[model samples]
Target: MTLLLSVALFGIHSLMFYLLKINTDSYSYSLLELYGFFTPIAVFIIIVLIFVHRKNKDAVGYAFMALTCIQMAANYFMLHPMLQQNLRPQKINFFILFALFLAMETIITARILNNKQ
Candidate 1:
């Protein structure tokens, strides 16, 4: 179910961005690349969360919590170059994609974290 949801969300997210790009071409930050890069990482996180939830239910949340800091650093690294630029649209695109995927990842992790009940 997690994999399926990720794939579906990936498609929808990609398609939504493409449609938005069709209307205006100011966005050149390679937001799709950002999404492409993180999608797999997100899946891996969910998988590890699941395994931890199974092997050590008590550690699943800790693992994810620890992972969140790494994620923040990684996200900053990826956006650092873009941050140097003064393009508002590119920044907007980056945040939109970032928030969408982050929310999805959070929901998946929340499901795993709550499964202990």
Candidate 2:
């Protein structure tokens, strides 16, 4: 699930950049910044989730949902200004993409949490 989500996001991101004709250098730098800042925190959360899952699957699922929410919030806060300044023309597209991503994430998380397994 995670791998699928990652690949989908990457493809969408790349397509957005291509279709919008965004400044690749600046956009790439921003993405690098986001990755560098969030990767460690995301890894730590996943590690903890793994441990928690062994004890309580539901708890881990909720944690994953919360983690996804936090990540979306952080992305919005961190990227909004950059999008406004650099990708002004494509800002709406970015927001739409982000909203779609969040909706998909929420659905996926809910499904995992509600699973009887």
Candidate 3:
């Protein structure tokens, strides 16, 4: 369920970026393009996690949580330069979306950890 929700959120975020014309610069465009690459890989990983989780919950759960953390870190690294340039509304929108994803990932991580105990 969490994997599905995460995928949905990513899809929504990507669609919002396209519909809003937020990728005005090369850097931002690159970020969006990176997401274009990442979303499918993430979906694949999450699907595999779902299957692995059914067989061996602990290891795969931890691995999935770690993958989410790595993804969040990558997001920060990609957005950091863009955030430094200016405070445009579109940039703010990106920040808000990033925060939303961060919150969701944190909550999912917490739930995974809680379930382990």
Candidate 4:
């Protein structure tokens, strides 16, 4: 499901970028590259969350919160190159991409966390 959604998002993002004519600036990763980079992380994070929930129900919430922060930090790492280059366009694009995945991840994990076994 995560992979499917990520592919869907990648499609939409690609369409939007094409429509808007957004170009990848110097030292900035392209949108396709960004999606590829984050997709596996998102997929793995969900897997970890599932395992955490199954292994210790009580710890799932804490794990979710901690992992979410880690995601934010990961986003920062992904954007650092653009930050160093002072590219507003790429930074802004990254922000949008991050927010989309963040929301998707939060919703997916939140559902898993809230499920009472």
**Top candidate (TM-score):** 4
lDDT of 2 by residue, 54-104 (tens): 679868777886887787787778666766576654455445555755565
lDDT of each: 0.74, 0.60, 0.62, 0.82
- Clashing residue pairs, candidate 1? none
Q: Model 3: which ten-residue window has the lowest total lDDT? A: 26-35
TM-score of each: 0.77, 0.51, 0.51, 0.89
On the 0 to 100 scale, the lDDT of residue 70 in model 1 is 84
TM-score of 3: 0.51
Per-residue lDDT, model 1, residue 85, is 76
Give, for candidate 2, the lowest lDDT window spanning 10 residues: 26-35
Backbone clashes in candidate 3 total 0
- Model 4: residue 114 alpha-carbon error in angstroms: 2.0
Lowest lDDT block of 10, candidate 4: 22-31
Q: Residue-wise lDDT of candidate 4 within 50-75, one digit each (tens)?
A: 99988998887788789888888888
Q: How far is candidate 4 from the true structure (C-alpha RMSD, Å)?
A: 1.6
